[model samples]
Target chain A: MGRRSWVGAGLGAALVGAVGVGLLVAPAGASAAPPLPPVSPEDLVSSVMTAQRGPFAGEVEVDNALGLPAVPGVPQLADGTSTVRVWSGGEDRGRVAIPSPDGERTLVSDGTTRWAYDSRDRTATRAPAGDHGGPPEGQQQDPTAAATQAIATLRQTSTVAVDGTAEVAGRAVYQLVLTPQPTERTLLREVRVAVDAETRQPLQLTVLAQGQGEPALRVGFSEITYGPQDPSLFTFTPPPGTTVRDAPARDGEQRPEGDRPRSTVGDGWDTVVIGQAPQPGDGRPRDGQDGQDQRPEGAPDLSALGQPVSGPWGSGRVITTAVATVIVTDDGRIAAGAVPQQVLTEALAR
Target chain B: MTTVSASAPPASRASTRSVAPLGRLAAAEIRWVLRRPRTLVLLGLLALVPIALGVGIALTGGPGDGDGPGLVAAVAGNGLVLPIAALGLALSLLLPLTVATAAADALAGEAAHGTLRGLLLAPVGRVRLVVMKAAGVLTVAVLAVLVVAVVGVLTGLVVVGGPSGTMITLSGTTLGLGEALGRVALVAGWTIVQLLAIAAVALAVSAFTEHPLVVLAAVLGGLIVFGVLAAVPSLEWLQPLLLTSGWTAGADALRDPLPLDGLASSTGRALVYVVLGAAVTVWQMRRRDG
Candidate 1:
């Protein structure tokens, strides 16, 4: 081999080696915390809650370590990292797009009208913007919304403290940690919100379960651009041929007659939402089910998921995720919360 | 080198006059590759995959009540996604195989045919020869992706988009024709870059072996190994180095408002492969005895 051959080999080796080092170095570089003035936890919480949200767009990534089975139809409930593209023009104008492997589910709100479209089913649900569609799912929940809601709901029940300052999505942030009080019965150990130091916006939210080294669930902005977003982003119209259904004025809560009313059983941090699991062949038309009966073919069997447990409350299957547990009683009651099995059972017993 | 110089004067003068320019050489290489019956057959066969996929989806009336996992299952009459979905499917194996085959034929096939010695004996520098061959490989990659994309898009628009030619994006928003085509172009362009990276690897392997089959085997085998490594959780540290790591990142082009992060990282990775592979090819060519 000539000297030129050696040189070329060296150059090739050097270039290829750089790629590996770069991948390793890039992530480590982001870990260096940016310096910022310290703020008390109470002030950080209040500022986050009262912050005037400016128009912005960002891609949020949710990492779920909930150990949930990947159900056939409801991919949102699967345990994995999912990305959501969100744009907000203001409080009342917003859009959220969650891209699956082959399809997307988009929800858009434009002050007066709200549209939720699923490309897989080709169905679009239109509703009044003011109608509460309930809290967004874990994957679709933005850090700002989830953090603020947690702070507002769990502040009194938890001990709040400023752990330190860190950088999230290149923004300096204060780490506000909320730990449940000693008497509080909950599965979650602490809820950490990364509040932007300058703008006071919550850039990241992480929830850890008891004794877990890693966060059970984390929702954070991987990339964010703050400015007046494109107004068109907040508006949506179902494409021609899409099945457009008008959601009832009450957020699609028109349940079949004689169904037990849904209720919450506990306070913040351990609240169990108890409801009736739709019975097989129930006449109720479920959301996004395409009018299929309950337990549609290929839908995951709930009994196959966690260990079976029976108690004074009656026999049921208890499925446990990293941060929450769900008990489906044989009698058709479903109770779920971020509490231990005992809390769920007690909720069911009540 | 001494013999050639001693016999230089008239031979060199006549040969120099007759020798084609670099551009002509590259054009000839590309034409030769495109004219090959095997290449044409492969491309014609590749074009059928999308048509088959689209027709199958249309016949089945798109996704069934059951949840099926596939690009076809997610089409739901959104014609714009069909081409992208087709490109995505082909990228996994078919397109890469095509690019690798062309790259193998570029160097190893020529060497096996004894034409490579004539090329080396010519006055064209070793680097120029490598560049010409790389251009040939690139041409094959571009044509392979274009055939799939154009055919798929046409099928999608006519069969699924209906006569309106309207496109619904993966973001669930309707897209204008111009913008939708631009998105498809973006996907097609990104896919070409990925295949270029694969071609570079094949060429590098081809440079070392006289048998084209060896080049094809090495490239495809390496890809399979890379795929396995990417799936292993513990080998995640090796992911960034694997050329196959972010192959799916091209789908991000179909997203609304467009995300460049995934595409950027994957492009950077592919560029690295191109540079490294080209370097290796040049080095081996430099050391080879004419």
Candidate 2:
């Protein structure tokens, strides 16, 4: 080759070789950043709990299998299930929604007023701050409240102990088992809670009702994130001419947040509650039922059709649903729960 | 060598007149550069870079994170990322050698062949001739890189096919075909910039030397010194100014929204070296007798 050609070819080779060295030094694209170190179970649980107390958003699912048939008037319990989505921006602002097959029932509360919106009917309900239908503002950001309540109740009635470890919602957690003592003849078999070791939050909960092998009820967060939420979710305005109902301030012990005014016969799995049946207009309609019952549309009905049956529980008509068995005693009392009739008879005997 | 104190000729007219002749010169230069058996061997070696990487990854069925992650790690995930991966693979040593050798022989080889004077007799200006040589070298260099990248993409698709076009970034964001293609172009562009730096430096070194091997050694020595300076913790302040500094910043283009800080710094440093090296070469060529 001529001198000039040699120069050209050499320069060409140089360009390729030099660039290969310069550019190829960097590694390829990817996600192999170092992972976080594992923390102890107690630390993880506390961390998750602390994390939940901050702003966060997530979805929770409820599954039930007590072999009860569909109830007449109740919307959620009749179907024996519910799904809830929660969003919060720390205390004083949050929203919890029940996304049903019919539509969505969302209750949002700031520190002041609580508002409920039904996307299906386009009706909005507003209540004074203290009387809000949803959880109070103080507990708004505490998404672990449901699990906390269950854990607290189990602790009071059963043996609370850590079994092992589990992974839930992509975080490592300690598996907490709550078993009723042999002395405690509660209807529940056991309760298992998956507590996050990092945040001390309950990531999952499983309730095994008496007589059932698999979990009778499972409730936990499916997706969860911790951060500030859009503030607008906490505020609600009745969308144009939607029917808006204003509720009085903190209506008497009529709330249905599993905190209703009721009396319990015992504690633990065998625990039975004797209370006035859920009535219409007290809380959101069950199952978002379109009022197929004899009662007015969108109203909660305490009564269900049943033939008379005499039992040691004192002659009552028994009504069974997918999740609960209700026995309306002849004496104006309704004993509705997942417990067997014999247990109710025993409660009556007590 | 002739020194002209007169004002330079009109650039537009000169550029226009130079186009056809420049094209022919470029073609002739490309023919001579590309046809050589040694050149073919070098190109074949360059093409092997991505193939070898792909085969290694394929054989391992992709290691957990595939050695060091980020650019090269894409082999473990998506084959579409292979082009970018190959570019990254080529950059460390293969690229430096290729550019250094080409630049080393640009002028020194002509002098050694005793054809420097005859080569200068062409009607083209000294600057124009230099520009043509640079263009030819750039064309060949870019082609070499393209061959490797394209071959990598094809081989990856063939051997370790993944989701057609989607690639996950280091930050875990997913990109579609369009964006990945853009990223490939950007990586190529960044490699070219760094390679241009080496080319100019080698050319300048060539102007001062009569042996191509010496020119190559100069570039090698220069890069080695720069690498050492960059490695020293106490001298880290000079890293951003080194010709070889932060060349890997181009990989950031694969990240969505494209981080600009590193890319800007690297390109700026490369540009400075390019201008400085080109100036020195021009001075040497203009002053030294043939």
Over the stretch B135-213, how does candidate 2's per-residue lDDT look in tens digits?
6567667877787778877777776666665665432345677787777777888888878888888888888878999
lDDT per prediction? 0.80, 0.66
Reference-based TM-score of each model: 0.83, 0.45
| Lowest summed lDDT window (length 10), candidate 1 chain A | A294-303
lDDT tens readout by residue for model 1, A1-350? 66975786867677775874486337634576777778766567657656778988998989888787665566665676778888999968999988766667789999898898877777899988665755346336554566566666667788888898888887888998989988888989998989888888889999999989998889999878899988888888777767899886562345453456789987867789998887656645544454455546312444556788999999989988888899988787889998899999888888
Q: Which stretches of candidate 1 lie over 4 Å from their true place?
A: A1-8, A20-25, A133-157, A182-185, A248-301, A310-316, A327-337, A342-350, B1-21, B49-70, B73-82, B153-163, B225-239
Interface RMSD of 1: 2.9
Model 2 - which docking category?
A: incorrect
lDDT at A108 for candidate 1?
91
Q: Could you tally the backbone clashes for each prediction?
A: 0, 71
lDDT of 1 at B107: 85
Q: What is the C-alpha RMSD of each candidate to the true structure, in Å?
A: 5.6, 21.6
